[model samples]
Target: MIQRLLIIFIYFTGVSNSTAGQGQATLVVTGSVHGQLDPCG
Candidate 1:
């Protein structure tokens, strides 16, 4: 049982880490788009 729990924890942690990385990437892309739209600023 302990082994199973550990596996689940590790899986979830990996998934969350990946999701956070993706979120950061998305933010960076959005920032680039905004800069293009408002070049005068």
Candidate 2:
């Protein structure tokens, strides 16, 4: 749903913004999300 779309969006942006020498960028996903996430903040 929303979460999957978010990840795909981030991935494309990261790929487009990667450096010449960098093969790919890494995203650090740090949080306490379990079941449903509250993104109203």
Candidate 3:
């Protein structure tokens, strides 16, 4: 469905933005993991 695709797009965009930081790769990974888990928990 269109809604599902839109959600996926937005989720990836957020992930991309979060991972674009400099000198903080671990923070990015931690943020992405938390983002994915906290929503379902």
Candidate 4:
């Protein structure tokens, strides 16, 4: 869906920009999801 396309766009952009220059780069991913808890053991 929409999420998959967003992930691909971010990946390609990061790769292309890095190869074109030599400089420090930063990537930050932030989000908040509200849903039912799932047991993880």
Top candidate on TM-score is 1
All candidates' TM-scores?
0.45, 0.40, 0.43, 0.41
Q: Find the 10 residues in a row with the least total lDDT in model 4.
A: 29-38
> Can you write out model 3's per-residue Cα lDDT over 1-41, one digit (the tens) per residue?
45654565566666667756433644545565666667673
The per-residue C-alpha lDDT of model 3 at residue 37 equals 60
For candidate 1, write residues 1-41 as lDDT tens digits: 45654564565556557866666555654565565567584
Residues 1-41 of candidate 4: C-alpha lDDT, one tens digit per residue: 35754674576557657755322222222211111122330
Report the CA-based lDDT of candidate 1 relative to the real structure. 0.57
For residue 26, model 2's alpha carbon misses the true position, in angstroms, by 18
Backbone clashes for every candidate come to 0, 0, 0, 0
What TM-score does candidate 4 get on C-alpha atoms?
0.41
Candidates 3 and 4 compared by TM-score, better number: 3
Instruction: Score each candidate by Cα lDDT.
Output: 0.57, 0.49, 0.57, 0.40
Question: Could you tell which candidate, 1 or 2, scores higher by TM-score?
Answer: 1
Candidate 1 error regions (>4 Å):
1-20
- TM-score head-to-head 1 vs 3, winner: 1
What residue pairs are clashing in model 1? none
